[model samples]
Structure formats: C-alpha cells, structure tokens
Target chain A: MTVQTWTYILVGITFALYIGIAIWSRAGSTKEFYVAGGGVSPLANGMATAADWMSAASFISMAGIIAFAGYDGSVYLMGWTGGYVLLALLLAPYLRKFGKFTVPDFIGDRYYSKTARIVAVFCALIVSFTYVAGQMRGVGLVFSRFLEVDINTGVIIGMIIVLFYAVLGGMKGITYTQVAQYCVLIFAFMVPAIFISIQMTGNPIPQLGMGSTLNDGSGMYLLDKLDGLSTELGFNEYTDGSKSVTDVFMITLALMVGTAGLPHVIVRFFTVKRVKDARKSAGWALLLIAILYTTAPAVSVFARTNMINTVSDQEYASMPAWFKTWEKTKLITFEDKNGDGKIQYVADAKQNELTVDNDIMVLANPEIANLPSWVIALVAAGALAAALSTAAGLLLVISASVSHDLIKKVFKPDISEKGELLAARLSAVVAVVIAGYFGINPPGFVAAVVALAFGLAAASFFPAIVLGIFYKKMNKEGAIAGMVIGISLMIFYMLKFKFGIFDGGKSAVAGLQKDWWFGISPEGFGSIAMLVNFVVSIVILQFTPAPPEDVQEIVEDIRIPSGAGQAVDH
Target chain B: MSDKQKKASAYWRENVRYLFLLLSIWFAVSYGAGILFKEALDTIQIGGFKLGFWFAQQGAIYVFVILIFVYVRLMNKLDKKYGYNE
Candidate 1:
C-alpha cells in the first residue's frame, strides 16, 4: 500500500479506538468530569500523565531541534525531565493531599482570598491556551503532510475529536483515551529510531548506538563523524555548544520549574486515590517520559548525519520521491540562489538553497531511510495521538478553572452539580474553537510556543503553589501581588524579545538579542521573574498579617498525608 | 505544643532533609555537571561520548527518574514510621 493509504488506515483505527474509550468511560457527574472520580490506579494514571505531558513538541519537533542545535539541545532534554523531580518531591504529594479538583481550587482555598484565586485562574487559562495552540498546530502539520489535506482542515478534525472526548468524558474520558495514546505514540516513536539505529551502527539500542562506531567499518564514532560533517558545512561541532553557558543554565532552570508548575500536570495527582499513589505515579510518569527523552538525542544524531550525507551538494532535479512530496507540502523548499543546479544545505544563509522545516525531520525520518510505508504511516498516527492527548488535557484544565473556580466558587455558589457539568462541557467547546483558530494561524513553531507556556507557568504558578504548601504564613496579599507581578513581567519580556513588539515588531528580533537583560533570552527569563515573585511575596508578607489560623492548620494537615480523603468539590 | 504537633514537626523535618539531599543530587547532575563544568568534563570521554554531553542529555535524565523513585520509597517508609500510612 502507498504511504497515504497506510496513514489513512492507521489514523482511522486510532481515532476509532480513542472514541471507543471515551464513550465507555463517559462521565456522569462533576466529580468524574473534574478528577476522574478520584479513583484512578497509579499505573493507569502514570500512563495517562506521560501521554498528556509528551505533546507534539516532544514527539515531532524535539529531535529536529536537537539535530540543528547540537549540544545546545541538552537544555531541553535536562530541563524538561529534571522538572519531574521537583514535581514529585515538592508539589505532587502535598497537592494530592490537599484534595482539590483544579489547581486554582488549591490556590483559592489555601490563600483564603477570591483575589488570589482569580489571579490563579487567569494564569491557568493563559498558560493552557498557549500550550494547547501548539498541540493543535502539531495536529494540523501531521494531517496536512500525511493525509494530503489542507492544514486548516486537519486542525478542525483534531479539534472535533478532542472536543468529543473532553466534553463527553471530561477527565475520565481523557485519562483512558490518553493511555491508548501513550501506547501508540511510544510504539511509533521507538520503531523508526530503533530501525535507524541498527541501520547506522549495527546496534539495536539507540542510546548505545549513538556512542558506538559506525557500521561502515570507518571505525569513527557517530558523534565525531557528525561533528566533522557539521563544521564542514560551517556549523558548530555536534558535541560542543555554541550558546553561552549562562543562557543554557537559565533556560534549563526555567523549563524545570515551569514543568513542575504547569496546572495540567499537577492536577494529574488528584486523580489517584492516595498521597502514596500520587508519588508513585510521578515516578512511573518520569520513567516512561525518560524512555523517549533519552532516545531523542540519539535519533537527533542519526537524522542529522543521514540528512547531511543525503542532501548536501546534491542535484535538485534528481532528488528522491520523498523530497518532491515534501516540497509539494511547501515544508521543504529549494531555491537556487546562485543559479546552480546543485542544492546547498549549508549553515550560511546567503549560500544555502534548501530550507527544511524542523518538524519534517521526525515525520520524514522513516521515508528518508527508505523504511516501509506502514512505518511512515505509524508515525502519523503517533503524532496525532501525542497532539490530541495533550490538547484534551489542557482543555480539561481550561474548562475546570472556568466552571469550577470562576462560576461555582465565586459567581454562583448555589449552582447544581448537573449545571456545573453542563457549564464545564460548554466551556470546553469554546476553548476548542479558540484553540482551533490558533491552529489555523500559529504564532510560532510547535516547540517554541510550548516552551513559552512553560515560562508563563513558571513565573505565575510555581512560587504561589510552593509557598502555599511549604510556608504556612504565606498570606493572600503576598501571593496575589507576587503572581500578578510575575506574570506581568513574563508577558512584557516575551512581547519585547520574542515577538519584538516593544522593540519595533518581529523584524527587529534578531537585532534585539544583543540587548537582552543580563544576556538571558526571553525563554530563560522565567527564572528571573520567578525570583522576583519570591522576593516580592516574601517582602510583602512582613508588612501584612499572617494567614488565618484555620489556613495554617490546613497547611499542617496536608503535610501529614495520613487522611487524604477523596477529592471533593467544596 | 501537643504531642501530635511535635511528632508532625519531626516527620516534617525528616522529610525536608530528604528533599534537600535528593534535590542537591538533581542540581549537581544537571546544572553543576551538565552546564557549569561541562567544558572541563568534556575532556573525558567514554565509548565515543563526551562525559558532559552524556550527563546533559542522558545521565541527568536517568538520575532524575531514580531520584523520584527513591523519594517515593523514603516517603512511604516515613509515612509508616509516623503512623500516617493509609
């Protein structure tokens, strides 16, 4: 069968499977909608969390980004995975014991102020919306490339599927469907990587293959060979980083703290039954996530080496079938700047003739290696699974915050359970439409938007939740001031540097890098803003009265972890 | 303070101690070895991989997974000792 036929078969089957799971696990009450009835098994919750956490960025764009960035890419690998340690140790168990359905629920009740809760709800919406837009774009990218459809059409299809499951089953539906997605995505990611590893190094394990000698009897190490090819093309060495050490350090810290602070990931703990289960599930989630995270760098090495060998200095007309197909999608374009028939894939912009989108490296890897059509099709299904699972998870947080925190807690205390569930479903539909709009017109690349979402979460949510649990005397005034200032700082920095809004629009972004504050990129500035938040909150606390005695007791009770009852709405 | 409050404080103290130890390792592996001393560590290589590069991309992630499990085991044991396990 052809690649498109295989993609149709595989994608169709996976969609059916997700819809089937959603229907079977359809939620009836607000409890099931918000926290999956607070009874998910640790193993199952771990699988769901892994799927929810690893989005299209990890599955589709990360290896491609690493292939280009070389050693600088380690910031992503370490920063994203290391955050789980902070989550498991500092956040998960205590939050689970607090026994709330949404992250804003914990913030509101712990701070004992509606103002603090409103700030939290606003941050959650912005972060989740920013993150979900990237997922929708990922879905569109996969559909347009594999199914031979328009990217906008692909996004609409993805939004409909996610809306169906997230609205019907809420957390319950998303959880079970995500488990299936985890299986599909992991299998799809590993198969091509393992095949490429064996083809290049005569080794089955990608991790070892990256460190082993090439299979061609050249006896040269893979990393050394890649480094040679890179410098020959005017690029940096594959094993040496070009980014300043401080920028890398700051970006890593931001991503780590942001991962711990993300509302969707933190809320996963509430689904499990006990505090111990929450801790255990975090371990399982990290192990599963680590499997993909560790293998990505190896795949990066392979794809980069293979890409350079195949495409550089090659004749454009004699290019392979896959190149032509990708060209039709406009993701890979060849411009003969010097009127030369040969394609120049060099690092120099003036001389370079070929432009390949970072997303295509993973999606086209199987085809680039002449793998079977079914393998290529499986990658498409895997990419969809990754994008849809994360989108559904983020949508749930959006709905829960709006329906539970804003409407039920603040606006309408006498609202019925059925009315709240209806509200949640309605908000999810609205969220999906907005997300789909962003999908049709993305602000940036998949990984870049996702990374900024982390920064936002790190600036706004991480400190508040940490202090709420760790510092009993963290008053509402301090938290509210900290969150508002921290998030505002993050947004200002992002607009000025990333979008270049403050420094004469997007065209001036390149020139503005030299003016970065303390030499930190916009992506890394979250750590700085988070520090400011901590300082401001602590300083404000001295002038303000301490938290109520009952609030202090609540903090003490969460620390014990003996009687974490079922997650309740009130 | 009451006996229950005192016992809770001790348990909390022990928990904080474990967090400090585990987080220290986490910081050392990723930030310390992976970034700060990466150039120095890159001088040493194993099986065609630079030490610092391995630490940044592979070693640190493996350590993170282990750290979580270790915390889980320690926390579980502490819960039982403090008569807090369900």
Candidate 2:
C-alpha cells in the first residue's frame, strides 16, 4: 500500500479507538460530566493528563523549534517541563482539596465575590481559547498532509469529532479518550526515534543515542558534529547558549508558573478522589510527560545534523524525495538566495536563508531519516492525538466556565442539574466552532499563542488559587484586584510586543523596541505578572479586613486530607 | 511515646532539606550552569562533550527524574514515622 493509504488506515483505526472509549465512558450526571465523578485512578489520570499536556506543540512543533533554535530552545524544555514540578509542589494538592468542578468555582467561592468569579471566567476563556486554537491548527495540518483534504475541511472535521466526544462524554469521556491518545502518541513518537537512533549510533535508546558516538567513528561525538554543522550554517552550536541570560531566566520562570496555573491541568487534579491521589497523579503525569520532553532534544539534534549533511552544499535538483514532498506542502522552501542552484547551508547568516517552518521539523523527521512509510503515518496519527486530546480538554474548561460559573452561579442559580448539563454541552459546541475558525486561519505559531495563554492563566488565576489555599487572610478585594492587575498587565504587555499597537505606529516600535522590561520577552513576562498578583494580594489584604472567621475554618479544613464528609454541592 | 511524640520531626525536616538540596542541584544544572553560564563552561570539556551543553540537553532532565524517585522514598519513610502510612 502507498504511504498515504497506510496513514489513512492507521489514523482511522486510532480515531475509532478514541470514539469507542468516549462512548463507553459517557458521563451520566452533572457531577460525572464536570469531574468524572471524582473516581479516576491516579494511574489513569496520569495517562490522561500526559495526553492533555503534550499538545500539538509538543508532538509536532517542539522538536522543530529545538532543531532550529539550537541552544535557545532550552527555554521550551525547561519552561514546559519545569512547570509540572511547580504544579506538583505548589498547586495540585490544594486545588484538589478545594474540590470544585472548575477553576472559576474555586476563585468565586474563595474570594466570596461574584465579580471575582466573572474575572476568573474571563481569564479562563482567554487562556483556553488561545491554547485551543493551536490544537485545532495542528489537527488541520495533519489532516491536510495525510488525508489529502484542505486545511479548512480538516479543521471542520476535527471540530465535529471533538464536539461529538466532548459534548457526549464531558470530563469522563475526555479523560478516558485522552488515555488512549497518550498511548498512540507516545508509541508513535518513540518508534521513529528508536529507528533513527539505531541507524545513526547503533544505540537502541534514543536518549543515550544522543550522547553516544556516531557509527562512522569519525573520532567525534554526535553532539560535536551537530555543533559544527549548526555553526557552519550560521546557527549557534547546538550546545552553546546564545540568548541573553535574562531572557532565558525570564522565559523559564514564566513557563514554570504558567504550567502551575493552567486551569485545564489543575482541573484534572480535581477528578481524583483524595489529595494524596492528586499528588500521586501529578508525579505520574510528569513521568509520562518527561518521556516525550526528554526525547525531543535528541530528536532535534538528530534532525538538524541529518538535514545539514544531506541538503547543504547539494544541488537543488538533487534534493531528496522527502525534501520535494515537504517543499510541495510549503513547509520547506528555498528562495534560491544569490541565485545559486547549489544550496549553501553555511555559517554565514546571509547564506543560511532557507526558510523552514518550525512546525514541520518533527512531522518531517521520519521522512528526513528515511524511515518506513508506516512510521510516517504513525507520526501523523500522533500529531492528531496530541492536538485533539488537548482541544477536548480546553473546550471542556470553556464550557464549564460559561455554564457552571457564569450562567449557573451568577445569572441563574435556580437552573436544574439537567439544564446546566445541556448548557455546558452547548457552550462546548460554540467554543469548538470558534477554535476551529481560528485553526483554519491561525493568527500565529502554535508556541507563541500557547505561551500567551500560559501568561494570562499565570497572571490571573494562579495567584488567586495559590493564595486562597495557603493564606487565610486574603479577602475578596485582594483576590479581585490581584486578578485584575495580573490579567491586564499581561494583556497590555502581549499586545504591545505582538502588535506594536501602543507605540503610535508599527514602524515606531519596529526599530527602537523597548516594550519588554529589562530585556524580558513577552513570553517570559508571566512570572512577573504572577509576582505582581502575589504582592498586590498581600498588600491589599493588610489594609482590608480578613476573610470571615468561617472562611478561615474552611481554609483549615482544606489543608488537612481527611474529615471532608462528602463533596460539597456548589 | 505520646502519639505526637512518636513521630520524629527531625526525620521529616532532614528529608525535606535533602529534597531541597537535590532540587537545587537540578535547577543549577539546567538553568544556571547550562543556560546562563554556558559560555564560561564551554572552555571545559568532559568525555568529549562540552560541559555546559551536556547539562542543558541531558544532565538536568536525568537529575529531575532521580530527584522525584528520591522524594517518593523519603516521603514513604516520613509517612511511616507520622503514623500516616498508606
């Protein structure tokens, strides 16, 4: 069978498995819909969280970013993975103890203010939407490549699939489906890496293969060759740090706090039955996620080395079939800079002008390594799994924010349970549609928007949740003001850098850019926003009265693991 | 021993301090030694690998996994001492 046909068959089988899991695990009540009845095993929750956490960006774009960015890409590695540590240490157990269906619910009750709930809802929507759009685009890209459909049609199909499962199963369905996705994605990612590693280094383990000597015995390590190739092509050596120290520090901090703050990730903790279960699940989830995170840098190094050795200094017409295929997809393009038919991939920045999209690196890695067509098809399936799993998780959060937090809590407290469930499903459909639209016409790269989503979440929701759990004195005014300032500053900073809207004209900030405070990129500014929120909350609380005495008792109760008789009905 | 007195606070404190020390090492390897001070460490090579490069791409992640397992073992011991064993 042709590679395209094999890809279609494998992908179709994976889709059937996911839909089947969702159908089997369909939620029966509002409680099940929101928190999967708080009965998920830590092991199962770990798998689901891994699938949800490793989105299209991790599966498809991360290796590409690492391949091209060289040492600079460590920001993503450290930032993304380190966030889990923060989540485990600082956020997950307390949030699980709070035992609410959604993040907005926790903020609303903790702050004891309707306005605080609304502010939380706004932040959740912005963060979830920003993140979901990237997932949709990932699904569309995979569909376009493997299924031979236009990107728009692929996005629409993805929307339909997500809507069917997410609306039908809610958290219960999404959780089980995400587990299946984790299996498919991880298996697919590893197969190609293993094959390429053995082919290049005779090492069966990709992680070890990265540091092992090459097969040719050129008296040089694999990394040494990569460093030489990259520097020769105007890229920094793979191991050398080129970014300003402050930028790396800020970005890593931002990602760590942002990961800890993301509503979708935190909500997963709530699905567990006990605080200890939540903690165990966090550890397991990090383990599963680390498997991919650790392998990505190896993949990046291998792909970069292979690309330069194969393509640089070769005639344009002699480029491999994989190059031609990727070029046809508009993912890999050559401008013929200096009108040289002989492509020069060299250390001169001017000559290294081959415009390669970062998203295509992992997607094209199998082709680059001359792996079997089945492995290529598996990668396409894995990318879809990563994107679709995350999209469902984010969509669920959006729906819950609207139906549970907004309509049920603020607008119509008297709504029936059944009515609320229907509302949640309807809102989920709306969110999917909006996300699908953005996917078809993506405003930016998957990583950038994802970073912005993290920034917004970190700024607004993380501080409030953390303070509410750890500090008893934090009151309504403090929580509300902290979220407001945190979210506003984040938005203002993002807009200033991303669009240059406040600098009077696009050209004004183009040459003389000064938006970032002390050389911090907008992506890394979330840590600052989070700190601002924390400081503001503490300062404001000193002036305002403490939370009611009953609130302090509730705080004490949440800190302990036991004596919570039953789940409180919000 | 009294119920509260049976649990040695020193054991928990020592374990937590160890976890902190290990985690600090992890942070230094990835963020400090690997990213910030990479150029300074580039002058040194270990086993044909640049010292800083090895830390950034490989060393820190390995340490993080090790730290987690170490913490888990310590926590189990702490739970036993506190009579909160699961």
Candidate 3:
C-alpha cells in the first residue's frame, strides 16, 4: 500500500481500539469516573501515566529540538525526567493519601479558604488550556500531513474521536486508552531510531549506537563526527555547552519542578489503592519513560549527523528526495540566501542552507533514511497517540476543576453525583472546543509553548501545594496571595518577551544581552517566579494566624498512609 | 519484639535513608555536575562525548533509571519485613 493508505489504516485501527476500550470500560459510578474506582493495577497505571506525560511535544518535537540544538537540548530531557523524581518523592503520595478528586480540593481544604481553592482552580485552567492547545495542534498536524486533510478539519475529527471516549469512559476509559497510546508512540519512536542506528553504526540499539564508533572507519566516534560536522557548518558542537550556565540551570530547574507540579500528572497517583502502590507505580512509570527518553538523544545525534553528511556538500539542485518531500510540506525550506544552486549546510550564522523546523526531525527521519512506507505510517499513528492521550488527560483536569472544585464545592454542594458527572462531561467538551480552535492556528512552536505552560504550573501551583502538605501553619491568605503573585509574574515576563511588549512594538525582543534580567531567558524565569511564591507565602503566613484546628487535623490525616477511611465520596 | 513490629519501623527507616542518599546523588549529577560546573567538566571527554554532555544527555538518565530499580528492590524488602507483602 502507499504510505498515505497505510497511515490511514494504522490510525483507523488505533481509533477503533481506543473506542472499543472505552465502551468496554465505561464507568458506572462517580468513584470509577473520577479515579477509576481505585482498582487500576500499578503496572497499568504506570503505562497510562507514561502515555499521559509524553505529549505531542515529547513525541513530535523533542528529538527535533535535540537534533538541532545538539547538547543544549539536554535541558529538556533532564528537566522533564527529573521532575518525575520530585513528583514521586515530594508530592504524589501525600496527595494520593489526601484522596481528593481535584488539586484545588486539596488546596481549599488544606488552607481552609474558599478564595485559595478558587485561585488554584484558575491556575489549573490556565495551565491545562495552554498545554492542551499544543496537543490539539499536534493532532491536526499529523492528520493534515498523512491524511491529506486541512489542519482544522483534522483537529475537528480528532476532537470527535476524543470526545467519544473521554465522555463515555471518564478516567477509567481514558486510562486504558492511554496504555494503548503508549504502545503505539513508543513503537513508532523506536522503529525509526533502530533503522537509523543500524544504518549509521551497524548497531541495532539506538542508545548504544550513539556512543559507538561509526562504521565508515573514519577513526572517530559517532558523536565526534556530528560535532565536527555541526561546527564546520557554523552550528555549535553537537555535544558542547552553548547556552549561558545560569540560563541552562534555571530552565532545567523550572521544567523539573513544573513537571512535578502538573495536576494532571499528579492525579494519576489517585488511581492506585495505597500510598505504597503510588510509589511503586511511579518507579514503573519512570522505567517505561526512560526507555524512550534515553533513546531520544541517540536519535538526535544520528539524525543530525546523517542529515549534515547527506546534504552539506551536495549541490542545491541535487538535494535528496526526502529534502524535496519535506520542503513541499514547508517543514524544510530552501531560502537560497546566497542565490547559489549548491546548498551549503554549515554552522556559520550567515551560511546556513536548510532552515529546518526542529519539530520535523523525528517525523521526517524515516523518510530521510529511506525507510519503508509502513514505518512512516507508524509515525503518523504515533503522533496521534501522543497528542490524543495528553489532550484527554488535560481535559479531565479542566473538567474536574470546574465541576468538582468550583461548582460542587463552592456554588452547589447539593448537586447529585450524577449531576456532577454530567457537568464534568459538558465542561470537558467546552475545553476541547477551545483547545481545538487554538491548535489549528498555533501561535508558537509546540515545545516553546509547552515550556511556558510548565513555567506557569511551577510558579503558581507547585509552591502552594508543597507548602500545604509540609507546613501545617500555612494559612488561607498566604496560599491565595502566593498563587496570584506567582502566576502574574510568570505571565508578565512571558508576555514582555513573547509579544515584544518591552520593545515598543510587535517585534521580537531586541538586545537580548540588555533586555533579559540577570542574563536569564524567559524559559528560565519560572524558577524566579517559584522563588517569589515561596517567599511571599512564608512571609505572609507569619503575619496571618495558623489554619483552624480542623484543617490541621485534615493535614495530619493526609500524612498517614493507612487509617484514612476510604476516599471521600464526591 | 513482635515479627510485624520488628520489621516495619526498621525497614521503613532504612528505605527512607537510602532514598535520601540516592536522591542526593541524582541532584549532584544533573544539577551540579551537568549544569553548575559544566564548563569545568566539559574539558573532560569519554568516547568523544564531553563529560558534562554525557551527564546531561545520557549519564544522568541512565542513573535515574538505575536509582528507581534500586528503590523498588529496597521497598520490596521493606514490604516483606513489614508483613505488607501482597
């Protein structure tokens, strides 16, 4: 079959599997809907969490970023994975013990203030919506490229499929679907990497192939070859330090904390039965995630080396078929800046030949290596799995924040369980529509916007949640002020650089050396925002009285793994 | 001491200390060796990969996975000791 036909079939089969799973696992009660009835096997929960965490950015854009950025891209790998450690150690178990359906529920109860809960709800919405838009856009891009549809139509089709499973199965249905997605995404990612690794180094294992000597007998390691080629072409060395020390440290720190703080990820811990199970599931999830994360750097190095060697010295008119195909998709463009037919792929600031989108590296790698049509088709399926699984997880968080946190807790405590479930489904549909709109017309690259989402989550929600569990004296006023101030500072810094607010016009920020504070880039400013939140919270709490006696009791109850009665009913 | 009581507190304390030590190593590798003193470490190389680059891209992640496996094994022992075995 043609690549397009194969893509259609693979994607069609995936959709059928997800819908079937949803139908089979349809939740019958509020408990099942919210937390899968707390019956999910630790292994199954681990798989689902892996799928939920690895969004379109991870599947579609991460390798591409590493391919182009070389050593600099390590910030993403370290930050994203390290955050999991923080989550497992510092947050997940206690939150699971608290046994709440939504993050805001924990914050509200812990702080004993309605305003704190409302602030948390708003923060969750902003982070989830911003992150979801990127996932929806990823879905659209995959469909548009492989299925020959417009991006918007692709997004709507994905929306319909997701809505079917998400509304019907709730958390239970989404959990099983995520397991299937994890399979598809990982298989899609590894197949290409294995092919390229064998071709380049005669080693089938991509991770091992990365450090092995090249088969060409050039007396150089694979990474060394890549470093040489990249620097020769005016790019930084493939494995050298390029970013400022402080910026890299801060960005990695922010992303790590942000990953740990994301409510959607933390909520997955609630699906297991006990605190020990929560910890075990975290270990399993990291094991699964590491299989892919470790392989990504290898893929990045191989793709970069292969691309440079193939194209750098070639005449522009003789560019390869893969180049032409990608150029047609607008992912790889030839600027002809020097007006020469021979393309000079070099690292020189002025002599770069191909203006490639880093997002396309992983997707286009199969084509670059001349892999079979089926592998390309598998990539299309993989991208959908990554995007849809994450979109489903984010939508769940948004709906729960509205229905569980705002409506049930604040406005309508008298609502029935059935009424609450319906409200959650309705709110999920609304979130999907809003996310779909932005996905079709993305304002920025997938990875960049996702980093911003992380920044917001880290700055606002993380400190408050961490303090709530660890500090018994933290008060309601302190929690609300911290969240508001944290979120506002993050937004201000992001808008000033992203929208050129400080440059007096809608142009990119000028004089990077002069504009940024303490030489920290926008991506790194999240650590600063989080620091501000922690200090503000502690300082404010000293003036405010401790939480009421009842709240302290709740805190004590949440700390113990046992003797907390079964999870509270919605 | 009671069989259940003997193992529970002892095992739990041991597991916590192990986690603390492992996490400290994780912090040092990624945040310290890779980022803070990266310039110094970059001067060293292994198999054509700079030392700092190796830590950031490959070494730290490999260590993280190993750490998790280590934790799992330790926790399993603790669970058995506490008579919480499934």
Best by lDDT: 1
Q: State the TM-score for model 1.
A: 0.99
Query: On residues A1-570, what C-alpha lDDT tens digit does candidate 3 reach at each position?
Result: 899999989999999999999999998876777788887888999999999999999999999899988778989999998888878766877788898787888888888888889988999998998899888888888888889898889999999988888888889999999999999999999999999899888889988899888988786799888877777767777777589888899999899999988989988998888877787788888888888998999989888887777777678888777788778779888777787777777666577767888888888889888899999999999999999999999999998898889889999999998898899889988988888888877866444667788899999989998888778788888888888999899999887875566767445665544678888888889999999999999999889888898998676556555543445775
Alpha carbon deviation, residue A177, candidate 1 (Å): 0.4
Fraction of real interface contacts that model 1 preserves = 0.94
TM-scores for candidates 1 onward, in order: 0.99, 0.94, 0.95
Q: Which ranking of candidates, highest lDDT first?
A: 1, 3, 2
Q: Give the worst 10-residue stretch by lDDT in candidate 3 chain A.
A: A557-566
What local distance difference test score does each model get?
0.94, 0.83, 0.84
Candidate 1 on B2-25: residue-level lDDT in tens?
Answer: 999999999999999999999999
lDDT of 2 by residue, A1-570 (tens): 778998989989998998898899888888889888888999999999999899999999989988888778888887777777667756776677778789888888888889999999999998999899989988988999888899899999899999989999999999999999999999999999999999888888888888888988775789888877777666677776667888888887788778888989989988988766777888789889889988998899889889888888889999888888778889888867888788876656677657678988898889989888999999999999999999999999999999999999999999999999999999998999899889888865445667678788889988898788767788999999999999899888877876567776545655434646887888888889989999998899889988998887677556554433324566
All candidates: DockQ? 0.94, 0.33, 0.45
- Residue pairs in collision within model 1: none
What's candidate 1's i-RMS value?
Answer: 0.5
| Segments of candidate 1 deviating more than 4 angstroms | A443-448
Residues B1-86 of candidate 3: C-alpha lDDT, one tens digit per residue: 77644554465457568768878988998998878877789898777567888889888887776776676676667666665545
Name the candidate that leads on DockQ.
1
